[model samples]
Target: MQFQKKEQYRRQEIWELVKGKEEKISRNFQQSGYERIDDNLFAFVNIGYQGHAGQAFPNQYDTDTERLLWYGKKETHSKQPLMKRLIDGAITFYCFARWNDDPNFTFLGTGKLVNYRDNFTEVFNKDGTQTFCLELEFDLGDNSIHPAWINNFDASFEAEPPDTKEGKEKYVRHKTRERDPAVVKAKKDEFQKEHGRVFCEACGFDFKKTYGARGDAFIECHHNVPLHSILGETQTKTSDLTLLCSNCHRMVHRKKDWLTLPQLKSLMERN
Candidate 1:
């Protein structure tokens, strides 16, 4: 496959690109199932079904807009360095899937590590069922519409990595955001005192107006300057913050050139 990880392609186009170009690979590439180049691994699977072969391992790879659940071999448990490599963040995993027998696939993009489980699901075979030991889940960036339903199974971890010391430390160091609740509340109170009620400063969206009791006084605050971008300890003022709806707050930081409140409101009005 002349595959660029970022581009979408139909199965026929993939076959056309690889055909006769490389004698080592099958002319019909996606049929080959898996490919690897150094530390990068890509797998193309037929969604919602399993291959009927004389095998004991699982092949039920399921994906949605938000997640991609992959299975690995149990026979290689303790023997496989893959378990450690995945958690060590050494390998980049990519996956593409087609619903049932479709001729095309959706590029699932480079998967970010979520966590893996042991003995997660059972794959039935001719003789009996095989309980898969290595089950990996990944976080795909956004969520919304799904193209098709192919075994939309509930994803869960039966057992996490036996060595979670490094994972735990890494999560705390990187994923946890440093935000002061006192400052956020102070800004909210300031807005309510002046405007008579706290609502999105940019869009003037009243959460309670839409969600009723569930969204009462539920307005999100976005830093005019991102906290991460600031170096060292600095004082935060209410003027440095803007009250926004959850949607607007996310949109503000979605791009590298962070949109100002006026910019967002202008775009909203134009559309």
Candidate 2:
């Protein structure tokens, strides 16, 4: 299908098209700077200005994989800036690539930013001034492209997941179950009773000890039991939960293989 331009559509408006649908409509969707990587993966290319030697900003793509290393614009420096929202692991980006013939973009596919790094590299601008760039990596979930859509692109490809050893190490961490607030509270109380304070089991980081009054009673609860292992509607036992600091909790979910408490503890020791 040929790419079309929607002069009136914004990112939010485009998201509405596939919000609740099981399959996205192949046609009728278009965004600039989006490129099709595979059946399920697409990239939103942020090429620097065409006036410069770099077509859009310079970027690198692994020909053998669905890894597109992209750079952010040069203007911002805030710690938690708006651009950071794109890599926050919450928003699902409907990627698009700019059309060479016109100032339009084509809708590629959907994905989520799995990882990112700031101050990744410095680039010399046309004006001879240097700017730091933020690098981002995205993962395509189950949103595969339609067969008809593949005909419109050059060739269809599949983004490979991690290798055997790496895949085995990475936990399928997406599945989760809702525990009752009472059960969560009970877990915390029991941990406090035994240890005299709630602290990160993996890192031994004590919130109250570090943050004083404001951090007291402020530890996070993590579900130790794998959600998929439970048959059905199983009661959450106190032993099924553990205490974690926000940092540790985030680290546990940072990769596909969710780290067990023991694994994280070992990682800390090695470091």
Best by lDDT: 1
Candidate 1 wrongly placed segments (more than 4 Å): 1-20, 26-33, 50-65, 73-79, 142-271
TM-score for predicted model 1 compared with the true structure: 0.41
The candidate scoring highest on TM-score is 1
Which stretch of 10 consecutive residues in model 1 shows the poorest summed lDDT? 147-156
Give lDDT for model 2.
0.50
**Over 4 Å off in model 2, which ranges?**
1-177
**lDDT of each model, Cα atoms only?**
0.55, 0.50
Cα lDDT tens digits, model 1, 14-104, are: 4445455444555435466655444555567555643556443333444334566666544333125544444333455666765555566
Query: How many backbone clashes does every candidate have?
Result: 1, 18
TM-score of each: 0.41, 0.39
